[model samples]
Target: MREVAFIKQNKEKWLNFEKAIFNQRFKNPDELATLYIHIVNDLSYAQTYYPKSKVIAYLNQLAARAFQKIYKTRRQETNRFLYFFRTEIPMVVYQYRRYFAYAFILFFAFVAIGAVSAAYDDTFVRLILGDHYVNMTLENIENGDPVAVYKSGSNWGSFVGITINNIYVGIRAFVYGIFGGLGTGWILLHNGIMLGAFQYMFQAEGVLWESVRGIWIHGAMEIFAIVVTGAAGLILGAGILFPATYSRSVSFKMAFKDGVKILISTFPFFVCAGFLEGFVTRYSGAMPNSLSVAIILVTLGIITFYYIFYPYIVNKKMTLHTYDSTL
Candidate 1:
């Protein structure tokens, strides 16, 4: 059917339904729900059948406005933050946990491999770090300032540059998912190896513990964001590899949606990481051991809650309330 014919047939019904809903003419809760559902069904069909049609666009706008009204009037906030933690945050955390875990395992495993390689071959650090960076660090260490590289720039300059660079890396990692995971894995591997080599360099200088306490204040979130980006890549790649119950195109679409959500959420984390690297990392030399310990602990706490604890709680609740349609 033509868009006009469809619109003419349904327009009166839709307008009457809207008036009934807006005018508060519902006889009961069941009637209200039924009306809302009809609106939802019509909206879905209109989008599917006449996606670019003016009627569909108008319907979409109408639905959105109506939804806002419904949510506004029915607002019942029993602590907004608590509600977010109890509901949206947990669900989001659960959805991305797989990607997060993949990122952590892949990066850490690479780090471990780097450590073993460094232990076996003294030249491996030189190979990974290049003679220039390795020699520079050694020279800095000899001067009794092992982490002076961070202080090379103005704080604001470093912060803006670093944040922009990290965000670019994250976006690239996400975009690389188009190659069906290979590209994403390669990007992650490159980063993971670099991180491993960097950390091993510090260890070789006999300052691995100090480096961890000092670097991880920001590195925790920074590295975690990289991992999340890797996970986004994996999610995109996985769709290409195995569409499962969906057609390949449909699966790819869904994967992209999920991956985008995960990637966007990491933006704030990257900014925080940049701020720490610029401000806190530059002060690592003057930082007290106590403050370093506290920061490390806090970083660990956040990682633990987001990666382990939050996901567990979400899955547990999901299992318990399997009957709930929202899941």
Candidate 2:
């Protein structure tokens, strides 16, 4: 490309970046880092292709300014943790909301498929859930305690074990995205099928409502985190498959970073789910119906509000902030 055309092509973007950096208008450190990476790439291109041109000098100056702004010592924000959850993660979520929607749709479709298959074929549930497990659950139901499986261990021991297991699952879901998302899809499909078959077993035994009341106490957060982790995997796959205007390498880097952020955001919710499972789910049968329902609804509401609605709110605020700065 000619130097003149190159300058003309990127001139507006460079100016906007300059304004963002100088005015401290970035939403978070990740956003700044992303912009800096792009600017550095542009600088490298300019140096190689137009080394003697004034554009190279201009880009060098801009890149230097961005480096200083990003890396130079500055006063630390007092509420860095608060800002990350309140602003950073939500913004990233909003940016890739489509991935979340896709993951949800794919997972639920598998769930429906599982449900339909189990309904038609009596043996399907046993096949998916394993014969031993189905037989054990049948025995538990006969003993008048369908969910007694939850009370098998000490509360604190259960909490620690469940939390570690859930975190490991979340990481696996995210890491498996490197296989171009197919691995992640398989994971979702397997889990969805298990869930559908498991629930159907309870329904077959005429205790569907009882099972729901006990299981959803922790399943709300636990299942939601799994879905979000699936989204992270899809994002990683999309980065490789659809590079858009950026080079494949750059796209993958950005996607990996963004996906990791989304995955990390689910850690707290996983911990919450584990805590509920260990401390609350075991006693779900003893609790009043109203209390169990309340716990399930509250957990679902909090996760829904944070992952779904909160992103829109934060993105709107960011858009308005950017518009005001332009004016």
lDDT of each: 0.72, 0.83
CA RMSD (A), model 1? 11.1
Residue-wise lDDT of candidate 2 within 234-274, one digit each (tens)?
99988888765457886788789889988999999999999
What TM-score number comes out for model 2?
0.79
Regions more than 4 Å wrong, model 1: 1-89, 314-327
Instruction: Judging by lDDT against the true structure, name the best candidate.
Output: 2
Q: Estimate each model's TM-score.
A: 0.70, 0.79
Lowest summed lDDT over 10 consecutive residues: which window, candidate 2?
68-77
Clash list (residue pairs), candidate 2: none
